[model samples]
Target chain A: MQEQWTTTIRPVSGWLNINLAELWRYRDLIALFVRRDFVASYKQTILGPLWFLIQPLFSTVVFTVIFGNIAKIPTDGLPPMLFYMAGIVSWNYFSSCMTNTANTFVANAGIFGKVYFPRLTVPVSVIIINLATFAIQFVLFLCILFYFTLKGAPVHISPWILLTPLLLLQMGILGLGIGIMVSSLTTKYRDLTFLVGFGTQLWMYATPIVYPMSQIPEKWRWLFALNPMAAVVETFRYAFLGVGVISTDVLAFSFGMTLLIFCIGVILFSRTEKTFMDTV
Target chain B: MSDTVIKIENLSKEYRLGTINHGTLYRDLQSWSARIRGKEDPNSKIASAGFKVQIGSFMALDDISFEVKQGDVLGIVGRNGAGKSTLLKIISRVTMPTRGEVKIKGRVASLLEVGTGFHPELTGRENIYLNGAILGMTKKEIGRKFDEIVDFAEIENFIDTPVKRYSSGMYVRLAFAVAANLEPEILIIDEVLAVGDAQFQKKCLGKMEQVSTKQGRTVLFVSHNMAMITSLCTSAVLLDSGKLRVRGNTSDVVLSYYTQYSGSPASFDFRSSNKFIGDDHAMLISGSVVDSEGNVANEFDIRNPVTITMRYRVTRPDHYRFIPNFHFYAPDGTCAFISGPQEVTTESGEFEAVCTIPGNYLNDGTYFVGLALSSMETGVKAHFYEQNALSFNVKDPIDNVPTRNGYAGPIPGMIRPKLDWKIRGVA
Candidate 1:
């Protein structure tokens, strides 16, 4: 009987135990959660899934008007509409994923208290659902990209376009990592819950969403590149519009930082999952 | 000597009293440096008073150890704060234990709350799949069982409707159906049966009975309803103040629970209870049981006349004619009787209303008395109502009232009033 025991629960022993196999066993549950999140968001709305296109489309329009036309910000030789659309498409996915993933523990504390599943399934599904949303909006961006290309706008498409999926994956991983870390901290110090929303807004400015990284002075450009999301957005534009500079050194730096943040997030999240019910 | 499916050893859970893990890191830093410097911590000196208050944390479950055998329906009986839910949480791995370990064999599914993962906006069919997946069932498994679930829930017509539009009864039925069909090796259920109507509750109990007896699975049930425990469980454990008080056959354990606590005279006091909910139309000060001699008692012989008394202060007398009432509840939570004052106008003052029951009227059982003050003019507008305001035991051990017709078990009824019988033989 002792040898055949299926599971053992105790005070979390020595180092962290992240049973990726256990998470794999709950893969169906992750899919269901993804479906639920996707469906429940637009269940009774008049626009339904069209609201997905509306968000980034409207944000691009605003950025094009305010930064491109009014403020006269340079688009690095690409059409302002296509340039802002590219940035918005990638940045929106990352930011929304971060916000939703950061709220995983606090929002689902009720479900967590009553049921036992791999806690990682929740954040994983958050990434997946946001990815689904990004895919839909990516289609909308492509339509605009085709229109700009056919109109003979000065956009140079590059071979790096094949790396678009890889860029999105990096952003998703980075968001999940930072989000879970914040979620763990916010469980006890709920002050972070309020600060996350405010900080994400501030974080957007620090990233090159409204302005290009080259627009920043060369002395301060490296500091801007340190924001992992800057590399992701820059790579996205370089791949699609083929105008923004692609630095392997900076891209490597961002990828390494994302990997580090993800490791830290997993460690904190695993530690927090052991006793989050008590604090949450 | 049976196969033990669950073994809990020296189990204890310490819960921080006021705040949970707040400023914990800062305090740990302070205390850790103090320990290194060979000095007492500055914040460890203040002693919090009362039972639930602690300077930092207190034990919710303390040194409780028990074993549950396979296929045994185990009843976990306790007061509200006796750590029953905490015990189940640890066993189900919903929460981690603080001090001990629980070894569980095979798959365990716990319905700590009904509809735990149910989303209101999702259709009933979708929610069934969602809740099933949350309980560790694969989608293919849920699909295979979907027909049986819809049939058992009796909601074939509403299966496609979002549960938000469902009546509370329908929601609970579908939720319970999904849970009952999980077919795990071990099942842990809290007091979720109180949600549905009587017929649904009966169906749920029957399903549970079939699950344990026919399927040969283990079950751990927690409920305040002693009658249900006595009828459903084969064995039981009683918890008192986070400690194991008794463990044995269900009848003995429940009887011991009744005697150990309910039989005490001082345990039925409602003077300190703030259960009275009202808008200041009236307020209940105390409620208790009194013998024919007019002294408050917790234990009573069946042949002795007893009176249920409630003392209250009427703040607004002219608002409506007050009907101060007493509700007698059997051990199974059924309302045995509801008696109140006559329809008469009364003034603002302190008043004590007593309803006396004659000797040989009530059957032998543990009973709870509730106090209610209502306005008859507005058609039963309750001004102050407190459920389970007081409790007592009705015993018939002396053969004073010959109720058993050569039967060994207790007689069933709310009342056992004796009537004169005549017999004539035409030989």
Candidate 2:
């Protein structure tokens, strides 16, 4: 009885008590969840982690044939394989994080109903796991970049390549923010779950994944730059191939959007985590 | 606040009867606009008591307040659906309370169900780490107690094997072992002891005792087993229909619950009942206990005979024999004996089975009878089973006779038959 607890439980009034320190204290749990998610998904498959590379590799070939060769999509003078692979890898990471994080509530309701942990740990682990997957695919992209360099294709490595990690970080935060917000909303309105997958697919075409940002007419280019992912993909292309749009305006707009989405996503997720069990 | 590990004040929870949020977005939007326009929602009307309510809510836990002192083991006893689980859920933060507050000292770990987050593909060692992390233990804490946990579970031989490959008993032991080793300041345990063997239960009780006494941790234990509650808990609370019925010393609270439970009825009405579990090939119409002359009796003379009459209507009776049975339970909740009809017959019409319990065979105490109807075949399939259908008291009054040299306290054991004995004087 000498040392008293500094903890109390009361009905939540409105916004969540977003305790960053509590989330920090649960860092090990987030790490284990990340490990578990990665290990369990590919445990019995013959291609274990090879699926990570094979997924984007196979998709890039299909995109090259359909969109590059037949559709006559301009790749800004970069090799079609290089162009498509970049889009595929970056888009795959964002979509997977979004889709998985969106299902975090319905998927883990069983465990959450029986135990108490920082609910934010679940979504944080999803982001980290998807980031690791992106790293693996990035290695594959480097190998392909090496082959093209030896063959002397006009693939200029710009100094802007130093900003690739920043681009990926922006995409990660944006996807995570939307995913958590959707996960919370879908608890009360289950129709949102059915729409999230289809919405993510349509969103890929809206970004510059299939076509370069230069292909858009000058008058409509401002409208296209509003998509935060478009900025990330275009900058990623500009950083590596030195042929796509890169400006202070696009980067500043993307950062602003990512911050807003991430904040709202966390607030919604933390609030829903308290009473989602009652509805779910 | 420092002396009390858990302080609950006016805690309550209300649950909607059916689908959450009115089951559609249209109704939700309606309510939202109503709030925006500063008007009462059209759907927020309370139903009168006499009418059939369409969509309504009930309070599972209603304004209950209590506290648990540091290092005190408090037992909560109640019948099923008495808001016991709801109370624990609110305290553990699995769900939030609808109103009021709870303040606690230090970390709290609740084991509502054992092995809650165990993945089947993970090995026992991996699962221990996973479960420990879920319960708020750091990786280093689990690693330090790894060997101690393995030894306590007695599953070192299968530690490396996947948990799915372990037998259910082994799985339970491993899960319980991890939970018992958690060194939280306050621990909450539900009815997880009913799964393991008796020996394992005893071990868990011993470990819990150590956790509270030696380590000075506060514990809140919920159990239906009064014997266990009386032995392991320092104090107890009795809940009845979402209210705190009584709270005091463990033995005193248990006695209050026992007396309240046995004071109900000598017969159960088969009508107006929905808590029945069976295929319903046949249904129990009525059941009661009576003397040989057919008078309803709640108090039986130990020297006489008592008959249990059960009336059931059979719908499908062409296949096998209908066996009606009675399971006698002593006051401490142990099955005393099971008696049923021996001769077999096939009958389809409504029938009554009267089985006589010969007196002078049972001890002087309160006894409860449970009814069961099964098909008397090679593989006995029970059609229906009902618990606590009828309860009665048995008393033995000596008339100008001396027994055990005027010993007047009470006799022990399930039966107190007067067996013949021969004694000789020794020089």
Candidate 3:
């Protein structure tokens, strides 16, 4: 009788063959990877998971002192502390996801060289871990937001708050796209490793994180539209604090650019993973 | 006959020689643009200056094709850089082959290295699940075998401790236990048994044997240990210089592998050879088998003791406690026994270690002896291991012997030791 082979390995695979079923089958591994990252990062530390909350809080205080107090950046008539906290919390999720996922290939090269799992699982787990951190920081943001509203500060919860999940999805996909693209390039050219950190720091300025989009001259405001993260941060602030410039055209453009980059990133990532072990 | 489970066709993997990078991004971009413009690579000129012939790609595996059937314990034997690992890597999907295809049926869990994704800070129990998942086991599957895995590793008390805190032996045991519990339809193992203690190695071998026989799983095992490949494998293939040299029954392939490489000579004189075998600690001079009369010989009587002697020079004496050992192997490559001195020597200079095998101990067959110098001061550190260093034959005379009692038929076993027997007829 002729036997049926379940898997056939060939020299070349289709460029867009992402193997979603195989990724689903290995979902448990992705969960374990996330848990390992969460547990290992805080293993020897005294505070443990509290560091997740402490990190964003510390960064907010620094931003409040340096950018708000020192530079005298306007918070669009909102309290400087609440304004900077919202922007820091929103920007932290995207930046952390991008920076962490960018090191996926180099950091996990040890395990990747020996086993055959979906290489995408590693970056996906990175995003999930960052999402969990974002969840904690988001809770902290809400507690402070509740205090400001109870004191009857100038804050409004807009109907656009319903777009929070969509905004998060866009940030995740955008980070994942840029992250995997850089990771794939670094496998062959290590020069990219040095550039990722510097590039992300510059990118935060390009997005309207510390200053509102209104601060940019109207003609140069179009330049901000080119950055996919600009829309995510502005929309997040508009939904919670009720004071940031956003338009439907900009949101649609951001979503389109995110999809485009994500497609390119997944294609490049899938192709590189098959043969990266040889070069890595 | 069982159906074929794995079919590899003309599989080949090519790798570029020398450094993978072109030193700088400027040169890389120059080469990339040159290629796009249909011009000769400017960087190739610089590379060809020093590396002329070595600048080209090298073939790690060359047109290798083989088939593995269900329940067949196939052994892949070859020298280093002979494409054994390349073949396994292709089959395991860890890397893509440059040419050809591999069609495999059912799940294939390859233990290329144990504890591949194990976290150092994770407890033993958590690492078990993590490692199991890395090897393609689901969390549910790992949970089901959790107790059995801890039991197999024999570290139940340390299950809650982080793996980094466990002893090296304990770490290896736990790692191997998780891999051994994997129930893949096809298992590929690559010399992972070379770790752990001797008793654990035996247990792992037994477990692998049961995996192939009782579970009816196809297994592909690669190891430099001839005895392991000979006993554990039902069929074996010999690869030389990235090419298939021989494929047949285990003993025949192993015999050809030895003859093709080491030549199975009667004696070795490393003193005259320019190639060195030992480290700065000690070096082997020569090894030979001798008769009772003290003359060098390769043939011995079954009833007479045959002495195997090793001569070596120890450069550093008091620094290490050198333990010299010899491994005796039957013609089929199954290790007959390993003998070493009970006491170690700390004195330096020339030393001759002789071990005598009494008559009637070895069965009538050809035997090969492997020599090694090791130190147990810290851990088991082998200075050098030269396999098939010397070979000899034991012959039994047809004349009636008291133990034989007029029967001339051949006796079966690794040895033929004479034991006291009492004949009391109860009937």
Question: Native contacts retained per candidate?
Answer: 0.71, 0.66, 0.79
Q: What does candidate 3's lDDT look like per residue over B12-64, in tens digits? A: 89999888878567789999999899977787856656555556788988898
Question: Which residues of candidate 2, in runs, are more than 4 Å off?
Answer: A1-3, B22-55, B112-114, B258-328, B331-333, B337-427
CAPRI verdict (incorrect, acceptable, medium, high) for model 1: acceptable
For each candidate, what's the DockQ?
0.39, 0.43, 0.50
Across B255-321, the per-residue lDDT of candidate 2 in tens digits comes to: 5676576543566655667544446477787788888789887788777777888888788775878
DockQ of 1: 0.39
Better lDDT candidate (2, 3): 3
lDDT tens digits by residue: candidate 1, A212-249? 77788878787966799988898888888887766989
In model 1, where do residues sit more than 4 Å from their true spots? A1-3, B20-54, B112-114, B265-329, B333-412, B415-427
Off by over 4 Å in 3: B33-54, B112-114, B265-361, B364-366, B369-427
User: Model 2: what TM-score?
Assistant: 0.79
Which pairs clash inside model 2? none
Q: What's the C-alpha lDDT at position A241 in model 1? A: 83
Candidate 3 displacement at residue A51 in angstroms: 1.0
